[model samples]
Target: MTEPVVIGSERSEVGLPAAMEILLSGGSALDAVETALRRCEDNLEDHYVGTGGLPNARGEVELDASIMIGSSRAFGAVAALKGYPNPISVARAVLEKLPQHALLVGEGAAFFAQECGFATADLLTDEARRLWREALGPSVESVEGENTAAGAGDEAYRAASLELVRRLAPHDGPWGTINVLALDRSGELVVGVSTSGYPYKYPGRVGDSAIAGAGNYCDLRYGGAACTGRGELSMRAIGARAVVERLALGDDPESACAAMLTDAATLPDEFRAELRTLALTFDGRHGGAAGQVGSVYALMTATSAEPEFRARRVV
Candidate 1:
């Protein structure tokens, strides 16, 4: 039998180091996820998913996060929150308070976070304000170009068309969503995901990051899986958990990830044409492999064996 693996993600602002700290100290997988997520909130880089992430299309900075603990089958999720200090901790609170709740969003989600004793913040910082100001330039330029193209015909119609085009234009990264999965020494599993949704995405839009079984999954009966890259794409394909289910049906982690990626590739050209990539990590043992994309890793422990993490590039 395979030894347990402890997997974690440093997906943008979320700190894998904090989670690693907990797991290495022999803490529970669920606790490690909570601790790590809280640490991410504390970091400036991680500001995108908590108090300092990018604002929505309406110029609001809302957050989304979720967690699943496999050992107890406990789960919690929140979406479109405006000022959560530590979204992962709020998610854990939701799980502890109501294990069966499928989702919570908006002000309700914010209130829940507050009730759980998680701090609230302004949800914007000097950096975010600067970025937003910068984003306005391109949008203004795009509008100016649109007006020129239309050649001064109908004012209202031209303005509307330009606005639509500007909204459709894609910006550069740091991309949204970070996924994590860990299998503890006691054979328990936990999976978590947190993201800023899409940068400049429509307000009130929630991505796969907060959705169960899309960007993250955990199951002792099937191992663990987590996905990063494109939220809309991953959600539509049900990527992460789908990979784990494929593994349960008899496939290695590489093959499973490849299968789901293949499915993603088959998307309609317009959808496939955008910024795209999906990265996956699996920890059958507990501590998963780390490598560039296309690499594969595995681990094994049986009969009083001590745990270890191993890896290799699979072409």
Candidate 2:
């Protein structure tokens, strides 16, 4: 059996420690990853994940999340989900109760959440509303607290599309999503990822976070990888699975992540943004890499009290 450990993306202060608690108690990796990610999904201060996350063009909190089990390679994901809290839990339910489906989107994902007993709640906090209104000024006022993407004129969405392009341009760093990967005493590895997606993205746009083998991927033999920034790049490259495949081919965690980012570099610059990856080898060794400078990841072990932060190796 491998020594239990947990690793997370940035802003996982509360998440990593909580996940470590689960591992220390001999919990399964699936439960630990879900618990840690749920903590992040509830963090209002962290606008990149669950509640309080940045809104889309229609000013709605459309959450995306996925959970993957390594040993069985079974995973479930939901994209464009709204009015529900803790999308990671919903994704897990899809894996457990609806094994035939691996992905659900839009109203379908929300319906599944409802069937599983997850009550619909307003995900847009006051702070998020302020940010949306401030970003789009009068464009989003009519749509506040409601989604009219289907009936609204293109005039409203036009502004958001332009703003989205501007935001995608080169910048200091763009951060979104929360990732948690855990290895338990039973040698199981699990990966969980959740995000509100690109700020002010066109309504209904799904990023890499909800795409298994892109944003989150794992195998009991090859380990797992989770993505952070620039979901577009990750999706184009199938980022997470690419890294783990390198590990299966004999690359160490650091080398595997570096190689994966190197391939991502081939993608066109028009949509490229800083892409970071968090990885763990099957034996529980952890490492990460970033397409931009100054990006970081976090890690914790069963014996540690807090997660240690590390700058990801730049591609």
Candidate 3:
């Protein structure tokens, strides 16, 4: 029997442990990811995800979240919602409620989150307040620039590009993305992704975190993945799922991930930016693994022959 596997951004005092809890409880990938992200929502780092993410220029906390189930090709997503601490749950709700393939922004999404039993409190916390204050002064322009792009050239790229600026505005410290890939005890393949909106972002803009195959993807017959780093860069580039597709073609997870990064470098200047990282985990014929999560964006994999996880950095 293939052993169950779980992979995520890093071992946060909250996220990693939450994943373990789900795994230990015999939960599937869906449960694992939901549990992990929920834990993150409650932790001090809550500023980046759930209800605590930075608002878009309008000063609203619009959130985005998506989930993919490999077996059914059933995907769910929610964009630009406030009052929902865990947008993933709301995304799942959208998929379950609709007869079609997708959903979009506004009260429809927020109404859905409320129906799913989500609770909301004042989003700004003491930690986040301090973060914003400390980033005041010269950093203010950078932060505000990310929040609003009134002069931003075009509408098509406005939302995503603004998020990138917001993510980069805070030079306060480096942060990690939360990712998880796993096959449940029942043998279902699931992928989950969650992140706070970019820092200093306008209140309502949604990042790649809510986009499937960009932030994360899963294939029961093949493998699964999740990513971290600059969402705009990864989303426009289709980085994480591309790596998994390579693995399906018999490339080991490590090589497949490297291949994806290599291809990104060839893209024209219109696509290059600060390096984003991808953390992929799969239940290979060999076993489960936690991919590389590093500064320069990396990938990792595991196979049945060697259950141990291996990682390699890619620029």
Candidate 4:
């Protein structure tokens, strides 16, 4: 039996302990991944995911999440999902109940979540609304017309969202999805990621977090990988899947993660920004890396008292 382990983003500090509980109890990686991410989603202070996350220019909290099972390479993802606090659970449900589809977005994803008996909540917290209001300034009043923010197809809202998308550095921070990757006692590998995406982004702009092989990938034969930071870099490089492919071809954890960033660097400078990754092998080896220096990730084992912060290699 392989030793159980959990690895994730820096913000996953809110989740590691809960995930460890599931792993130490001899639970499956799938369960651990879901539990970990759900815990993070409930952290109202994080402001980068779930309830307190920053909103799009229209002042909406659109979320994205994905889950993958290594053994069978099963995958499910949702993008631009509003009103759901635990998108990871919804993603997992999609994996189990809709194997024929790989992704769901917008109204379809929300409808499916309702079918799954998931409760809807106002994902926007007071803090999030404050941030959105501060970010939008006076223009928010004009952009948020009488029509509901969700249903507003007014040209003013569209133009405002586009303007915000153009002016802001899409990757203003080094943060992205909270990736929760777990290796179960039975040796199964599962990777999950959740995020509200770039702050004040264009409405309906889906990032890498919602794409399986881009932001996350897994295969029991090798392991699993997840990306954070700049989601576009992962999407462009197919970073998560590339990391797993390298591991399958005999690369070490560190080298595999570094190569994933290198693959991302091949993108034209205009398209590139920050990209970070966490990798775990089926045999239990793990590491993290980033396109920028001084970045860090979190790791915890069944025997660990707490998650360890590791400096990510700059590649």
TM-score of each: 0.77, 0.92, 0.76, 0.93
lDDT of 3 by residue, 86-160 (tens): 777777777677738565566878776666677766666666656654544333334344565455544534565
Please count the clashing residue pairs in each candidate, in the order shown: 10, 0, 14, 0
lDDT (10s digit) by residue, model 2, range 1-315: 679989888887668888888888889889999999889989887777888888776678899999999999999999999998899999999999999999999999999998999977789999888876776666555554565455546664665667664664321233578889999998999999999888877789999999988999999888999988788889999999999999999988878999989999898977666788888977989899986677788889877878888888988
TM-score of candidate 4 relative to the true fold: 0.93
Off by over 4 Å in 3: 11-13, 136-168, 269-272, 275-282, 285-312
Query: Against the hidden true structure, what lDDT does model 4 obtain?
Result: 0.86
lDDT of 1 by residue, 1-315 (tens): 223344444342245555555665667778866776666665665545666677765567878888887655567888888877677777778888866685789898987777777767887777875676576554433333443444554555456544653464334644445555665666677887776776666678887778777866666676667665557777888877777777788776656766777776666655343222222233453322222443322222232133223342221
Deviation in Å, model 3, residue 307 alpha carbon: 16
Model 4 ranges off by over 4 Å: 144-161, 170-174, 269-271
Clashing pairs in 2: none
Clashing pairs in 1: 3-285, 4-285, 4-286, 5-285, 5-286, 5-287, 6-286, 6-287, 13-46, 48-53
Ranked by lDDT, the better of candidates 3 and 4 is: 4
After aligning candidate 1 to the native by TM-score, how far in Å is the CA of 232 from where it should be? 1.5
Could you tell which candidate, 1 or 2, scores higher by TM-score? 2
Best by TM-score: 4
User: Cα lDDT of all candidates, in order?
Assistant: 0.61, 0.86, 0.59, 0.86
